[model samples]
Target: MSELNHVPRRPLIAAFLSLCCGPLGQLYAGRGKRSVTLAVVTLVLMIVAAPIALWIPGGHVSFKLLMFAFACWPVFLIVDAFQCARKARQQRLHWYQRWWLYPLVFLAYLGPVSLISELRTVFIAEAFLIPTGSMHPTITPGDRILVNKLGSRDDVIDYGNVVVYYSKGPGSPLYVTRVVALEGDTIEIRDESVFVNGKQISEPYAAFDGELPTYPNMVSMQPVVVPPRHFFALSDSRRRSMDSRMLGPVPIDYFQGVASRIFWSRPRQIDFSVSPENSQIGAIAWERIGMPIR
Candidate 1:
């Protein structure tokens, strides 16, 4: 046997590569076939599991189980890669084993997985943290909520649904607000009261600090007609919200999804107009946890 074949593979490098890029570690350990197989399996599992998980009824425990399975793919790959590298280091290799085909196989396997992951983020549900009181009363600061990326795609986004959308500028944070008006609807706000299509719409969930009305801003003139493929959103706490009144109507393409539910909530000094001056201990807002956002 050649001297090169007698040398042990570097398990640490393999592990690190796996951590950085899925299945790359297998290639590093000269296991091209294993790397390709693992990558293909991981991608297939993720692609198949995501829609199944999302389709499961939200109330069922199996939904969470499926989601857990989808999320564990990365962990599974990492651990398997580490173990494969460790075992490969223990075994003597033939000179022919370390071939250029390994890296090519790794790249071939990685491309599809990366593409699927990106598509999943765009078309599936994703978690988001509420960092401001812009959507207060419906969503609070420190609350973790799930955004259903497929919500609007599958069904018509109706009035009064809370939606998560992208901001206009590059690198802008996602904004969550209530859909008050849809395409072709006429919207007007008088003395903080919302009127849609010439009728006053009752909003029981709307929060107001006092008798203060919606401030006169750039978009707060006589009835504004919502354009085609656009929506008007407002904060539940209207007095403090910087929503469509300030940002203008949001295009349909900008929408990410509708806010589904509060998965977690922590009691912090929320920046609402009526927040308490001091934070409290054991401050988890238990009532808000698992509360579905309407």
Candidate 2:
């Protein structure tokens, strides 16, 4: 058999390091292009994935595409790190050159979740998982939604608009509710009718069963006074929801922002995983791939 041609140590080292953490080992072996590209990509991905991991509510990625990207990063990092070390020793590169791999490995510990949070939060895009069916038919269980952190408008809170606001106080999960009434509007509920400003507020979005008030307190619009800068809210699923009825009206300060859209929707299984590792961004419903929120 013919002898295989000899490959250079530098190329071998670069290839190996790139696998562990991308071109890092090759840089130690004195390859500029190889090292820089790996570093840049790793940093870019770390920045992107970190935020998604941090605040994408329940620590799950709302966007399937993003989660897919996040899952592959660490594998690349470990492979590249290994390759870089191999090349340096073979090529007899200087000590400091090989040491760069140490910090790069430390970065691997930062994990994809942390990196996504740090980078995405800088851009003001926050996302969280929908944990309940209160906003059903609009937002379902296990749906991931994108929230505009700085897009909340107080005086502009219009009726029938679905909003994410603090329904419980400073220490509760931000809820998604439809605005039913504005300040001093004389809101009232009876049987299944809603009267505001001495006129009924039209609620087509409210579920039929939810069309009426199901206040846990059974106050039935107990002649409540909605303070200024406060807005009355209700669950879209009226009969099944517990909103301003039980908790009272939500204040402008309690308003977080509007529910923008459903970024990703999956089957109703909290913390669900299809596979053993559940590492991959598995099958998604084709009809809802990019369906916009109403």
Candidate 3:
């Protein structure tokens, strides 16, 4: 009877570790080889899938698939940990022996995984919230946008491309604006209308809050040639935006990424200038959610 009966195992503890840092519970349950295998597989999948999903055409579909895979990964680890704990109990393995291993296992398993995830966010892509109406009509003050850090890699930054760049000014460190002129292009503003290479460009995305032919006292400047490796950018709201006209052309190195799409948006009280105040209580703009930014 003693040989036939299985010792009891704590399923809750196993599940907690697996969910917190995948496969860690398996090691705790004395399934060392299996835990190592699961960790390697998860890391390999992320390494292979992330770049493909971000860089290739029709990659959004692959990205969705990868996201689904990630969602399932933790669940699989939890189930495996529970099952392994049961097996270890059945095999009459001591549950609490070698207690010193827990600390080492945690540092080895969780530390590297956390570092890799952070590095991915820093280099691959990330999201940001729009706090101003500068890009209004296209992107509003309460919209959350995804920025693809790899968007400009191996590609040319063309006119009309919306980008996010690090600003060295007093406001936010990052600013979102549209590229009006690329390297070697001539840009001039006449009465708020943008002229590139001596030709007036059509700007359907541009918006003005009030009935005004042009922004009053808007600085008018002569044609200026964009220096190499730099870009001239402006906001859609010509009247309210502080852009290249005030800061000069942005350097290529200052660029952080390109705006991919609007993930979320909300309409805030018109009077509130602070972002947190606007988000406190507001109706969701369902129509604007998931809207793609051009």
Number of the top candidate by TM-score?
3
lDDT of 1: 0.73
Better-scoring candidate (TM-score), 1 or 3: 3
Model 3 stretches astray by more than 4 angstroms:
1-7, 48-69, 86-88, 94-97, 151-154, 169-172, 210-221, 263-292
Candidate 1 lDDT, 180-277, residue by residue in tens: 99999999977677889999999998887644554565324578899998999988877666789878888887888888767668845643355633
Please say which candidate is ahead in TM-score: 1 or 2.
Answer: 1
Is candidate 2 or 3 superior in TM-score? 3
Candidate 3 lDDT by residue in tens digits, 101-145: 666777887777777777767787677888777898899878877
Every model's TM-score: 0.68, 0.62, 0.77
Backbone atom clashes (below 3 Å) for every candidate: 0, 25, 0
Model 3 clashing residue pairs (backbone):
none
List where candidate 1 sits over 4 angstroms from the true fold.
1-17, 25-32, 45-55, 60-67, 82-90, 94-110, 121-129, 144-155, 166-174, 210-214, 217-224, 246-248, 253-256, 260-268, 271-292
In TM-score terms, candidate 1 sits at 0.68
